[model samples]
Target: MLPNLDDIAPNMAGLTIFSILHAAPGFSQIPTQDESKLRTMFIAPFGRSCYAHVPVGICLGPEYFQTKMTECLKGREGCEAVMITQSSTKRH
Candidate 1:
């Protein structure tokens, strides 16, 4: 589940945050060798929203998987400000 930013930081009431849940099976199982395919599959779904505005960050679940996802998102158009976050409170 995504963190309730409002509950954690009440001062962020005016901020606009977008949260994408990766609940689909094998969503994180895509092979690193198929980066193009991975980009196609992942970005297509959220391309419009991500590109609609700047300063977009893509948060992935499970801290360990973030490294791979970060590489995938980096260099992609409109993802210049992409920030990856693990779905937990513990610091990585």
Candidate 2:
């Protein structure tokens, strides 16, 4: 069982935020104000990239979510999963 609204914690000051986009069919979830700020951190034209952490609530879930994702990533259906990430760093 996932945590409910009442279980949500306050956004700690200076903490970074990330968004997940798998719940909505065919489209991503709306970005919160924090996400907008993070987007601004990207320097475009020259180059732009996101060194972000995936939202925990969105990533960690019941078996249903993880199972499908794991199978889908391991070449289960002619699909490939590739993530380009660097050494994890503290965000804020």
Candidate 3:
């Protein structure tokens, strides 16, 4: 299930929280072996093209990004004050 922001709201009571957003986050860094799997064809008058990066509509993009963020936050101090999901990350 998608994470519920309300469930974590109580934990932030009386604490200053900050949220950071990265523009166009988590797509271009795809591994070479996996790029082909994320490709799509264009049926136009000219020719066809494919994506070199993962598209936002790909089924596993969000989950993969979340997993990477989780790994990155592991063992860091005040990590418990942080909440991460496919769309955003909040810190307090």
C-alpha RMSD values across all candidates: 14.9, 16.4, 8.5
User: Can you write out model 3's per-residue Cα lDDT over 1-92, one digit (the tens) per residue?
Assistant: 44367977766565554555453455656542454653554456887666666667777777776676677677764443443333223432
Task: Tell me the spans in candidate 1 whose CA falls farther than 4 Å from its real position.
Answer: 1-6, 9-11, 26-29, 32-92
Query: Candidate 2 — worst ten consecutive residues by lDDT sum?
Result: 23-32
Q: Report, for every candidate in turn, its global Cα lDDT versus the true structure.
A: 0.41, 0.42, 0.57
Candidate 1 — worst ten consecutive residues by lDDT sum? 49-58
Instruction: Evaluate residue 32 in candidate 3 and report its C-alpha lDDT on the 0 to 100 scale.
Output: 26
| Cand. 3 Cα-lDDT | 0.57
> Regarding lDDT, does 2 or 3 come out ahead?
3
For model 3, state the Cα shift of residue 67 in Å: 1.3
Q: Residue-wise lDDT of candidate 1 within 13-46, one digit each (tens)?
A: 4445534545233234543333333333334555
Tens digit of lDDT per residue, candidate 2, span 1-92? 55444664443334344434344231122233455436435567978754343333443333445564666566545433332322333431
Q: Clashing pairs in model 1?
A: none
Q: Against the hidden reference, what TM-scores do the models get?
A: 0.22, 0.22, 0.43
